[model samples]
Target: MDYLELAKTVGILTGISGGLALLMSIAQNTIGNYGEKEITINGEKKLIMDGGDTLLAGLIDNEVFLPSACGGKGTCGYCKCKVLSGGGQLLATETGLVTPEEAAEGIRLSCQLKVKEDIQIEIPQEYLDLKQWETVAYRIDDVTPTIKRVFLRLPEGEEINFKPGQYVQILAPEYQGNDEEVYRAYSIASSPSKKDEIELLIGYIPEGIATTYVHQHLKEGDTLNIIGPFGHFFYQDTDKPMIFVGSGTGIAPNLSILRYMQENDIQRPGIFLSAGRKIEDLPMKEEIDAIAADLPNIKMIWSVTGADPGTWDGPTEWVTDGLKKLVDDAKDSEAYLCGSPVTIEQIVDVLTEKGMTEDEIFYDKFQ
Candidate 1:
């Protein structure tokens, strides 16, 4: 082996790598420096911010919270705003998330848009009222064999107002062995009428950061940080028949919607379909069944993809199959679905094929 030659090659490669990193840093400080910029939102509020940060970050820093389930990772597509001016041009990263109609209206993902200059934009008026609540973990219960329901109580003299079926982002701070502090979105399982506290149904993923913290580290009376009711997936006040398909922890939002429906005496025909791998996989059945019994026109259906023949006698089918077989008013009824991305896509396809238009189908995909 030529030791001297090997050392020379290694030295040359290291030097080149170091030089590239230095050049990148220099470029960031020089070409990428955006200096101070003004962000005018809805033509009512103005904020001065650094140009190098994302529009989402700037807004959040200014106490204007927008929902970003992916936390500004260029995914989730929740943090969208109308960039009325000075947003330059749309980038490839936003093409998949923003539709043509949205693009034509200058809508872009706030996380993907950098504040490069004085920017004028428009956002939902409600976002200005968002608050990061400091609450307590009042109780945690096993909603199912694999899922847990976390009950959070607002601090004294405080309350959270939200539409049933909407979700909130909870912060999972850095704990022992895990250094990442991430915020995760969870659907509110409790009724919105319960203003003092809210409930969330969380399924324990083997190593999921937020779920791990919730199932393992979170405890009663523990202080928890929560953001606002930040999702479009909510019960719409309409007379159209409702078809709700939820799987796994996706049942959380539907539970909220159903409870709200019962509380408000919403009488339009409704069906709640709960799907899982087995009977034990189902969550919140007794409560849902009770809610169903209260609603005059509501029916509850159970579908299991993997049925235990010895102990389970329910229909062995997917929720998508149940959605197709049970829904009769797909052409006019509204469908609200929640679950994994693939499951939501399958349900959407089934509903659309059954004569439902895209606008009639709404979903909150657990991404």
Candidate 2:
């Protein structure tokens, strides 16, 4: 009644347990596997990518770099795309960023929308042509106490053909205590004419991943990976006079536009108003002055908000104030502004009050 009966019972129990374990392993693999999915863009192009990633990330992996100021954090609301079908449902984060009409029209924040299955999306044709470039940090110079001018040289046979005011995303590799890779966008300060080289005016935010990496860890000749030529903020072709405004590192894009205008001999009259906390905080003044000297129709004005009226030679007011003094009629002019959201909003209100319509003003709001 003893040994043989006990061994038989033990063998049966062990067999059942091993079968259950094998079944569980099969279920995990099947349920968790999100295999390849198709992404049809603009009803014309189709991409086959691995599923289970966000739409923003999938698009980036496929070499389509969308404009995302917050680097897929869903805060910038810049990576908006239209999903005709198969995007699942609207997320609260997406709803907060897009309006009701936009949501109804299939507009969604790409960063918040996951691609679990086949999907159809519509993006601008320009985005289809975007490319990721491999570059090297050729040089770094301190433009201001908090700003560093980093120059990047593209690899052989590679060149970035971006508009003057467009921006590029720099990859922040794992370093020090930060173990995850991330990206941050910075406007290209160098002219588009300089195809092989791009410059970024990066402002160091306390403990910022990309900025801190550039400021402290990134050295000349270090390899850098960047995806570029994003954003709609750029010089528009119009015969109407132009007004350019910027603050801090916001001057990066404006400088690119100005250089393009000067190099190409675009004779359209332009007035650049740059503001900073103090005179010393305004970087690239010499470069701006030299560009303005060659372009007779271009005028440069510098303003410092936190400077003493008696000591500073430049205007002791906001750049918008300097803008008001320079132009009397804003009705016929187009205004381009770049700065923090608050600063852009204030300048926009000023421009509107001066008779410029909302559509006449184009701005890039730094998040």
Candidate 3:
């Protein structure tokens, strides 16, 4: 085997391998590609999109953002949509989120459903109008030891029109020790009257990506991205007396609603019940007190579950206990609740037991 002969053989083998690689790439592009497909939404709007991404991602790419607290990880059931056709079989994640009745009615989690072909799905009209906004962190106020109120200012000529109790998804950029960008939903803590500014009452979770960024890395003048006006936990436009229950930063949305009511002079009798582990856990106490003072029809109650009754000035029972004391008949009232899933579940059971119908009790479960 001479050197030239060996060189020629090696070159020939390299050329053959390169040719096969090119062919494989071409095959993948041709075979794996699902190409373009149509997504018919609510039988009114149709979108032409490439058919490969998950339904949630595809909707977002088409400017239709569905509420998913866990992004597209299929953990939060907030992105459930009715798929009349072409959603294929339900996966375990979808089944976990959807009840048997819901599954029978064609409900599926958008995050778990892939758009492999033309599909028809139904989403709320409000979700169709959801928008992603660019804002700057104009202010950060320490509300408590672990909670900070961040004020994001919209750019000129831009505004967010959101219901008082709705929330927005904050996009946390990559920072030290966190290598990827992520989105986390936080309820809008500011009143709807403040169209150009959005406030978020973010509680610091020691190692949480989004909370950590907001607490430690995020600063004034830093640009942030958010998409929202999500969730159906807002106040209904009815004359029924209202009950608002929350804990920790869960009070953010309730505070927004109270402030909005105060701004608009909606004086239906109401009670805002807030619970925390300790005095320090309850943020926005002064603001809540001021709102309650201004609105004669509204009352505020504070409860500390983990504190000793001898030390706490307010109710020492759970928030639900305060709720029971304030409301005599839940059949005539509407309730808006926000908190951890367990807390929301417990309160929902209590409300239902107290004669509040399922439709009258709206809640946002924090994941």
Candidate 4:
């Protein structure tokens, strides 16, 4: 063959070989049957999976799914398990969450820990109560221009029991543009004192699956499935003065906490500061005002980032800036905060700088 023909022939052969190599690699990784082995989980004897896969996948493959919010992404430190024995050395990806003591105790991020041999593991007790629920959307109301209040009542008799500040993961069902079920977390806006119904304050993000569905495509009586009540973000039983700060959907869990305090007649002295881009962004101002009015010890301050001249009268600055003027010192107060990671970091820095002890500051941040 001539030069051009010979080059074309070599390219075709290379492509075929590449395809075969890819197929063989996939087959070697997933197609063959992994041999049987006895694995002990939390002191319970069980026969399961054989070698060469991460322990998280092995457990899931054997019908035991861990509490992994990021699927197998390992970015979330949620998939932690205590490997009593047979687990190898600590993994690099898990070192951030697991301390040296914890590593010595055999605590490892299950997603990053591989199951080469039979192993034992322990999960948090609270996770045992976690479950996935399928429900129908009962209502949707615009809480603000950018925030939607979604109410989902369990099917005729199904019920959910969760704390007020807890959150749930909504499965973004496959739609025209996406084929995978994406899981997004949202706080429970309703009071925990009530059961059988759940409420969420969903903030819209353009092209975001769950947010888009809640804002546009979702209708009353649509089927939805979710799992959670995951994070521990609630009020502590203390009489310390409270300082609450939130913006955007971060307002979701804080609202629940305030409502819980109101419902229980908690008269602990406190101030709540909420931030928004404009007056229209203040979703539940009226309700919040009503609660404050009813509770003489509670106060509310609303900060608008981009206030209109001659239209808005609230503090015209960032939320943290306004909060700085409220208290000269936060040394004795307890703060409850929720928001994006950047927002949380800013607030935490300010609180610490203002003399608030590390123990007095608590936050629920979205990662």
Candidate 5:
């Protein structure tokens, strides 16, 4: 090569080295600065965290995990905490999660509130009960064409104790195609009597991260990580006549409560109203029917919105339409409702028209 060409090549090499050094410096300034100011939480002092992260994350990183089902997505509304002082103004994303009274009380969704400034926050004592537990999948079976029942056994001699109707967050394992694990909450189907095994009735949402894992990727003997028996969607242990309404996998928790009542010989007149698009969607009917038959005061009603070609002889319209003629005197009844958001709202309206007070109806609005 000519001397002129060699000089040009040397100049290009020198420039490339300088450019790489500059890029490294910028990265160190941006990504490497995970250390920021010290923040106090509920009077306890903690180390300086990397600036720009949400307060919830910093708490989790410091081993004070918050009760967040949406993983900082700000959708579940379970991560709310009281920012006693120093926290900034609430972000727009947190508006839907907080009520006017709560806002006045200094309540904020920890996941939405960034810890740019050192701040103190208060969390519920019950929230401190939340913990991560590693479990093993003892069994996975297709309960229905659309629903699968997964039973996770806590390690031998281990216990996962929680109240009936509470839900647990199952961590979807990371696979080659997926980069991170995601949590999906499912109501515990197992009775509170069984403390070691956690059961879930999962409805398959096609190609959904957690559902797909439960439906296709998971298997017997595989280990799965899960967290908490959170949520308050169970039976209230009242003597009033009860109305149970569920559709799809929403039926899981209701069934557990019903079985518990039966085993304990708790006699209270009750009606279970289940709705489905087609006959196939109504799986576990025989078991539910048996429970109803064995319990003198328990009644079961099945309604199908979209009829099957040749088999259905039940109500032909929406499930709430069936409630019109059934719950004539809803004033004396306690209603438990679980289903999709739109369906639950419509059913609530019908229940209200039937004289059921808003306070008497307990519902878990699936988001």
Candidate 6:
């Protein structure tokens, strides 16, 4: 058998298939342009955008931002908006993400819904005022072996307004061998009062596009595009006591909320637990300790799952265990959680079982 010859033929076919896919995409975006169509937003503002693109892309191109972590990919499901009319049927990619209620109420993933015909959609009025920033990468650091700590500087004399625990979408440009430009959302780690510069913690995720670009290609002083302050997951200004649970880079927004509490002299009782595989995986420890020191009401707990007992002195248990022990104020406290979907869901179950209502809990799950 001519095995070598067969291998060569298979390789040739694979290359041709990839090339054809790229060509199809170009044709779809350009030659397939459906001309211009009017998008009536909330029946208040109307935008004229060329068809053949996702409604998400059209809205973004027109400076209206929606919370999308996976760009126009149908995976994130963060781009859900109601289409009052003219939005086609839901795509297969969205079936797993949208709930039955959402599907019944005209909710659709904007990234999967094409701008065919004139579409009338419902968008939150606040989204109309969202801002985009062209900033300089002020500084970058390898905070951990896998995590890069970045500080993006807003323009001189300009400040961004964001609530604690909110996140921003960073535009990851095509770099090195990467061929696509996509935006990935990350929670802001720095205090909102800092204003001029926002800090982000990005953990390298093997071949993940955004993490690869941030870890391998981005450099200090480079220009970065930012769109945000998106997501409903944020600090709620209530008199209730608070419990914050986070893991890995999920700690970003939790720390932001803690810093806000310290800076603003918010003295409500608070319990913060940040979990990681090892002690080093937990970033910004000293700053968190400082915040705790300033606010007597704040109690800090570090949960390490895989750290050596001789080297680490903190609790060596899952966040759920730590949560069970420390959530004494559950019924009177609001809980903030951030982590992977499984972790967030597990913690939510614990919180609810511990007497915290769903209304008293907020979370940001990294999909």
lDDT by residue for model 2 (97-170), tens: 99999999999999998888999999899887878877999999998899999999999988899999999889
Q: Estimate each model's TM-score.
A: 0.86, 0.89, 0.86, 0.83, 0.87, 0.89
Window of ten residues with lowest summed lDDT in model 6: 324-333
Q: Which portions of model 5 miss their true places by more than 4 Å?
A: 1-24, 27-51, 61-65
Residue 261, candidate 2: how far off, in angstroms?
1.5
Candidate 1 vs candidate 5: the TM-score winner is 5
lDDT against true structure, model 5: 0.80
- Give one digit per residue, the lDDT tens place, for model 6 in 1-367: 4999999999999999999999999997777578999999998899999888889999989999989987778889889899999978877888988988999999999989888789999978878878889989889988778988899998888788899999999999998788998989999998988888899999999899989988988889998999878878888989898888887788899889888888889898878888788888888778678888988887888888898858888788889888877665478779899999898888888988888899998999895
lDDT of each residue in 345-366, candidate 1, tens digit only: 8888888888899998889999
lDDT of every model, 2 decimals: 0.87, 0.87, 0.88, 0.79, 0.80, 0.87
Q: Candidate 3, residue 167: CA error in Å?
A: 1.5
Backbone N/Cα/C clashes per model: 0, 0, 0, 0, 2, 0
RMSD of each: 4.6, 3.8, 3.5, 4.3, 3.2, 6.9
As for model 3, its CA RMSD to the true structure in angstroms is 3.5
lDDT, model 1, position 296:
69
Worst 10 residues of 4 by lDDT: 30-39
Give the Cα-based TM-score of candidate 1 against the true structure: 0.86
lDDT of 4 by residue, 144-184 (tens): 88888888877677667777678888877877776766667
Residues 146-168 of candidate 5: C-alpha lDDT, one tens digit per residue: 89888898877877777777788
Better of 3 and 5 by lDDT: 3
